[model samples]
Target: MSTIGSEGWTLVHQARQKHYDDRYYGHWLGTRDDGQWIIGRLYPGKSMDDGFRDGEWAYSKRFAGDPSTDNADAALTAYVEMAHNTFVWDRVFDQTVGEAIDLYWAGPEVPDAPKLAAGWAGAESPNPDRVVSSAGCSIAMPLHEAKFLLLHYLRRTELAAKAHLTKGVTVDRHGAVEKVRCATGPIRFEYGYNTYWLT
Candidate 1:
């Protein structure tokens, strides 16, 4: 029995704007094929009037039969998880401290794969209450803040790898970006643009 529609999808869940600071991002759960479900996230539109939008499948899974609510819920969680792990520069302004953070995980040294701790790089220690056993986080912040946050962690000798910052960026917010700044060294930014015109 094919649950998916002719368009190739069946909507199961939709994100509640109340849960996301009233920002209308589309985090939807559905099935593109029978027995296979996915979480699709529509990137926020431009000024709410952008004729077209873009999106991606953040997570997907196949089931023995049709997936249960529990499975759908897990996929929704993955939707949020993917959002927390992706730092879309322009979208950072809508994220809060809780949503924007970095997590440090134990490397191969610990066979059990324990998540050592979670916190942003700006602090001297990981947040005491936010300890996670198997999770990770990602977000964007100013270059100086990133430096202060990662410098100590990078110098740690116990970890199997060195920590480094990605994307040298500094943002200003006064209703909108008032200024644009970059780190002192060589800098690069990856940009992709998508737009559609209404007929």
Candidate 2:
């Protein structure tokens, strides 16, 4: 483990030998000059089995084709930032939850009636007064009330995940909440009440 910056948190690093080859290769977590923590790798010699193997292990020319200034640091920074900002974090949270809600509420028949009914029941009481004042008349209901309710529930879940991811916090192997100290501060995860946080 190595400390990246002022946050006093240590980054995780690991090394392993490729199954077919005895050469040792490893990756380490570090921070960019722009204040982003990223995982960097040191590859061994060239091999056809590895995804990055082109031909030889000449250091000067190895990264020449890289788009991010042909710099390992830059590539790692880009990857970590992309994962944090676009793929693994809140944007993904919103997309996944939104899709789930839309799928569930797309059809006329409610997919999860028991769960939906439970939520609706919790929102209101039995014999509650309707909005309409006319005798024996009911208020016109929105066409997608159930869908809206589902969206609300999904949004709440996504928010929880976002909060956790951003706070530099994580759950431990034993199911305990632990503070994740990073150079950028505490990382919060958006894991919800019922979901697994560590994975």
Q: CA lDDT of each candidate?
A: 0.31, 0.31
Per-residue accuracy of model 1 over 1-199 as CA lDDT, tens digit each: 1233344755554442322344444455465433455655544543332212323343344332432333433554565565553322234322221122111111012233222221222221234765324212224343434322332222221122211121122211110001111122222221111010100
Off by over 4 Å in 1: 1-7, 16-24, 47-73, 82-199
Alpha carbon deviation, residue 123, candidate 2 (Å): 12
The local distance difference test score of model 2 is: 0.31
Alpha-carbon runs more than 4 Å astray in model 2:
3-10, 32-34, 45-199
- Model 2 earns a TM-score of 0.23
| lDDT of each residue in 1-199, candidate 2, tens digit only | 2453343423332222343455544333332333333343435534323412332221211122322222433433343443342213334533443343233322344333322110211111123663322111112223234334333433344333333432334332112121111101212232222222111
Name the candidate that leads on TM-score: 1
Q: Estimate the TM-score of every prediction.
A: 0.26, 0.23
How far residue 97's Cα lies from its native spot in candidate 1, in Å, is 23
